[model samples]
Target: MTDCLFCRIVAGELPATVVLDTEHLFAFRDISPQAPTHVIIVPKAHYANAVELAQAAPALTGELIAAAGDVAKQDGIDSYRLVFNTGADAGQTVFHAHLHVIGGKPLGPSGLDLH
Candidate 1:
């Protein structure tokens, strides 16, 4: 957990364009943004992935999701994508629980392809 990127960010050891900060969650702009407004939300406590976070801290899990909605609303996004990649095959580069709030333009039918 000490080496986790999100954890380091939460600890203020890294620099990120902060969007929102709550008691238990942190939201920041993604460095390599997939959309015009791409934000990554993560809990202050570390977890390997969504499933792990959900299983370990259900309340925090809810908070994480609610934070996503708050982020979208703050960004004035009517429609957006909430992405939670679970593994390497699913495009999860970081082994930490996080949610991606991606929106800014029409995402097309698939919506998965953010670019």
Candidate 2:
């Protein structure tokens, strides 16, 4: 976990455009924006993926969702997309559990094509 990117970000060892930071969660603007309002919400404590995070800390998982919602509201986004890429095949490059909150424009009918 010490080498994890999100963990470093949470520890303030890396620079990120932080949008929200709480006791258990950290939300920041994605370096590579997929949408006009793209943010990545990550748990302060590292987990390999969504399933692991949920299994180990359900409450923190909920807080992640809540933080994402709060971000959407703060961004004034009426409709947004939440995405979790669990593995390498699923486009999860970071290897740390995180949520992608994308919106601020017509995101289209399907969210699958997003990467």
Residue 94 miss distance in model 1 (angstroms): 0.5
lDDT value for model 2: 0.89
- Candidate 1's residue-wise lDDT over 1-115, tens digit each? 6788889998899999999999999999998887788999998888899999999999999998999999999999989988899988888888988999999988776636321
Which candidate gets the maximum lDDT versus the true structure?
2
Off by over 4 Å in 1: 111-115
**For candidate 2, lDDT tens digit of each residue in 30-100?**
88797889999999888999999999999889889988889999999979999999998888889889999
Clashing pairs in 2: none
True-vs-predicted CA distance for residue 80, candidate 2, Å: 0.1
Deviation (Å) of 54 in candidate 1: 0.8
